[model samples]
Target: MNITINRAAIESIILEVPDVAAAEAFYTAAFGLGDKLRFRASEEPTTGFRGFILSLVVSQPSTVDSLVGTAVEGGATILKPAKKSFWGYGGVVQAPDGAIWKIATSSKKETGPATRAIDDFVVLLGVDDVKATKQFYVDHGLTVAKSFGSKYVEFDTPASSIKLALYGRRAAAKDAGVSAEGSGSHRIVLGGSAGAFTDPDGFAWEPHLASQ
Candidate 1:
């Protein structure tokens, strides 16, 4: 006889919000996650969890969506805009459970089929000096990888995997495909796991742990 095991593909979830109204508006506007998938009041109530969908609450709804939106819009050139019925698009959102939402624009894909069935996660970070930042991870116990043009970097850790990029504060803004006056926050809390420090130039890095 043959046997098989079943598992949920999505390993992690992050939701961001400034206020209830804003959270409701942003997720609906950005990911089309459907408004108030959980509650009808502002009491922040968390319902039950179904499979991979984990709900977290946000105190406020205002979030930094411009950068994320721009990146998704740019990447859409190579990918496809997420559809309502898509497997990658189906998830639950709830209140009171402390839902943390990260609102980024969806992408549109080309004709090629996906070799890998599911994408686990995509991480973006800021860096002041690419060379020095890359070295720091190498020394602090991360296996570092990079693209040829110094455009992107990656680090593998036991707890988690992270993508560390070298962007000259101003240039980094352009990488995100946005225009910002100065530097953004360069820190990662790592959900209480091991944390990594950035270099003098303000390059930040994080570790991602693959869920089983």
Candidate 2:
């Protein structure tokens, strides 16, 4: 495992699903994220939550509904409906391939008509020990952007790059409206410039060669 880069940023997320074609179709129609998300074929037995969530940060509540709506139309299971919350307006949905996604926006009001513009793509890793995993990522050359004790931490990543964050395992599960009882592989490989390595939580990463 190579972990020798400076200020590593996620270049892409490769989801290992049972059917790459179907997953590609679903994600394309749902998020329209393009090459930021990749897919491969795998039969790894992953049940319950996958210990991670692909968080889509949009500009407004309307956009949140737009993305969540398309996802549900594409066969996604809604865990949380879009609504206003203390943090903002958002919702949670599980993709057809069993990947949990949270679409949200800090803005409670509509700025304008809904557009397919995503402000940020954040990959939240649910770890047993947030502080320990935060240190592990720091050692792997990812700088800390925000830290709220051990409960939450967001890494500083390059602009237009996928961001990374950490949250308590059970807390993450609760946010996704699921139980923290997942087992087997995460079935998601994060690609970045940091070289190939597996985090303490068993999240695998590879050298990002291309978008596809």
Which candidate achieves the best TM-score against the true structure? 2
The alpha-carbon deviation from the true structure for residue 50 of candidate 1, after best TM-score superposition, in angstroms, is 34
Clashing pairs in 2: none
Query: Per-residue lDDT of 89-139 in model 1, one digit per residue for the tens?
Result: 222222222332222223323224322121223334445565666676566
**Candidate 2 lDDT, 4-84, residue by residue in tens:** 344478988999999999999999999998888999899989888889999999999989998999999999999999999
TM-score for each of the candidates: 0.40, 0.96
Q: How far out, in Å, is residue 94 in model 2?
A: 0.4
TM-score of 2: 0.96
Model 1: how far residue 28 lies from native, Å: 8.3
Estimate candidate 2's alpha-carbon lDDT, on a 0 to 1 scale.
0.91
